[model samples]
Target: MKLVSYKLKQKPSTLRVGFVMDDKIIDVQEAFLQLPGHSTEMEYMLPSEPNAFYKIGIPAIEKAKKAYTYVMENQVEEISFHRDEVYVATPIPEPSKIICVGKNYAEHAAEMKSEVPDYPVLFAKFANALVGPEDQIVKNSKTNKLDYEVELTVIIGKEASNVTQEDALNYVAGYTIGNDGSARDLQKRTPQWLQGKSLDNSTPVGPWIVTADEVGDPSNLDIHSRVNGELRQSSNTSKLIFDIPYLISFISSLMTLKPGDMILTGTPDGVGFALNPPQFLKGGDKVQLEIEKIGRMENEVIEGEFHY
Candidate 1:
């Protein structure tokens, strides 16, 4: 099953959690209420915020799945919505932690003139950097080099610490698309990538989350990115230097991997900074990223203002 976070045009400030199937969005709360022998107080069983819903662990997923089943069986239309009638937001918009993997792809490592590390090279992005597929990547004038890196991000489903690679997949909620937007000049200006990578509105996280059951194997999936419909980076997740299971195990060893934590598996080669003449993103540029099983993300760049 696919799940999404959306905002109706009328209710722009409130983010609504939804269950998406066949391009339709089902309000998880409303759908749950329609189930036979349902309780009104049980509405609290589901949270409007994606991260909070995830924090409840398996119950959250089961609630949506049950709702989906009821909707399909009863053919309910009142609880359903057309996909385009709302604005999509990042699936886990307020994740507890946003851990990123750098140079997890060998070619991406080569293009950046960096060596593959023995362990996962990790970094962080905050909630403020998060944007949805429909949101614009604000072109901040602080730096001139803007780049895109399409990554298949893992969403944590359970609390895990020091788990073995064999058991790591058990704790994964599912997978989704992520664009690790960066400002190269700022990145190179200092060793800490937070300034370059964590700019506000830079990271476009999702159209929705495809549950692990639906996605099956997280490895060996086809992932690609494009600029204005022209393909820029194309590769399979098989090329990841550190695959999902290993990443989870390794990262968990350091800190507990709780539900709602996002782990970006890193990007492949063909980023703009590694081009022939180095093509950086400018206003009006459209970036698109797609992953097999998971959905696609298409966002445009617009010049943002500074009120200093």
Candidate 2:
């Protein structure tokens, strides 16, 4: 099942959670209300926010699955919205921690001229950097070397601490696409990459999350990125130096992994910075990313500095 967080055009401020079925988004809360057994308490089970939605744990997934199945089999039309009628937000709009792994792909590590680490290299982005499929990535005047990193993002489903790599996948809610937008100049200027990595509204995170059960064996999917329709990166998750399970186990040993937290599994070779003449994103350039089975997301790059 494809899970989404969206806002209706008529109620722009109100966030709603739903499931995608045949390109139509079925509102989970509304679907619940349509069911005969639904109670006022069911409303609490389905929050408008994705972060809280996951905090409910396995029952959240089960309820969403039931609603999605019911909507499909019963032809429930009133609660479903067409793709263009709603604003799609990031699957986890306010992730507690957006943990990013650097140099996870061997080719990407080579292009950056960095040694392959025996341990995972992790960094972070905050909620401020998160944007949805409908948003624009602002290219500020302060940074001249903007780059894109397309990664297979893992969304944690439940609280996990000191779990084994073998048992790590059990904690995953699903997968989504993440564009790790970076300010190359700012990144290279300091040993710590926080300034370059977490620019506000720079990263575009989701079209929606494809539930883990629906996306089995994520270790070998095709992943690619295009800038202005020109393919810049083409690779596979099979190339990941530190796979999802290991990363979860390694990170969980140090910090608790909670529901709605994200892990960006790093990008492949062919970033703009590695080009002979770097091709940083400019105003109006569209960055398109696709990971097989998870779907695609495109965002426009707007010129000028962001205010506030």
Candidate 3:
């Protein structure tokens, strides 16, 4: 199932939770209401936001599946909307923590002139940096060297602490595409990288989240990036220095991972800053990222003021 957080284009003020079926989006709450035996109590069970939907666990997913099945079988059109009728937002807009991995690809580490790390190199991004696929990636005044890193982001399904590598994938809800926007100049200025990595509205996260069942093998998938129609990065997830299971176990050992928490499993090579002449994103540059099973994100870099 491809779960989405969206808003009707005409009613953009309120956020809605839904799932993609063919080219149409099915409103979860609306569809659930149409179910033959749905009760008032069940109405409260469904959430209007993706974050809350994920927190409800398998029961919520089961209810959504039932709703989709019933709606499709009975040919319900009142609860369905065309893809263009709604604005798709980040699958988890306000993840509790946006934990990111750095230098998880050997080639990426080599290009940056950094050694391959023995452990997963971790960092964090706050909600302020989050942006949907339709939003522009802001080129703020803080730095001139804006760069892009395309990463396959994992969304946690349940609370996990001290989980083993074997059971790690069970805690993952789905996968989505993420562009870790970085201000290269500011990143190198200090030993810590949080300042450059968390610029407001810079990280373009998702169009939707493809459930883990659909994305069978996350470790062996194609990943790529392009800047204004020109391909810049192309690599496979097979080269990940720390695979998904290892990363989950490693990260969970440090702190608890809750539902809707994001884990960006590092970017592959061919980033803007690693080019021979060091190409960096400028105003009006369009950035696109794609992962095999997940979907693509096309975002433009625009000269904009930071929203305080």
- TM-score to true structure, per model: 0.96, 0.96, 0.96
The residue-by-residue lDDT of candidate 2 on 86-116, one tens digit each, is: 8888777787889999999999999999999
**How many Å off is the CA of 158 in candidate 2?**
0.4
- Single out the weakest 10-residue window by summed lDDT for candidate 1: 299-308
What lDDT does each candidate get? 0.88, 0.89, 0.89
Cα displacement (angstroms), candidate 2, residue 173, comes to: 0.2
lDDT of 1 by residue, 169-235 (tens): 9998888999999999998898899899988888899988888989999888999999988899999
Once model 1 is optimally superposed onto the true structure by TM-score, how far is the C-alpha of residue 115 displaced, in angstroms? Answer: 1.4
In model 1, which regions exceed 4 Å deviation? 11-13, 42-44, 305-308
Q: Rank the candidates by lDDT, best first.
A: 3, 2, 1
Best by lDDT: 3
Error of 2 at 183 (Å): 0.2
Q: RMSD of each candidate?
A: 1.8, 1.5, 1.5
Q: Alpha-carbon error at 105 in model 3, in Å?
A: 0.5
Q: Determine which window of 10 residues in candidate 2 has minimal summed lDDT.
A: 41-50
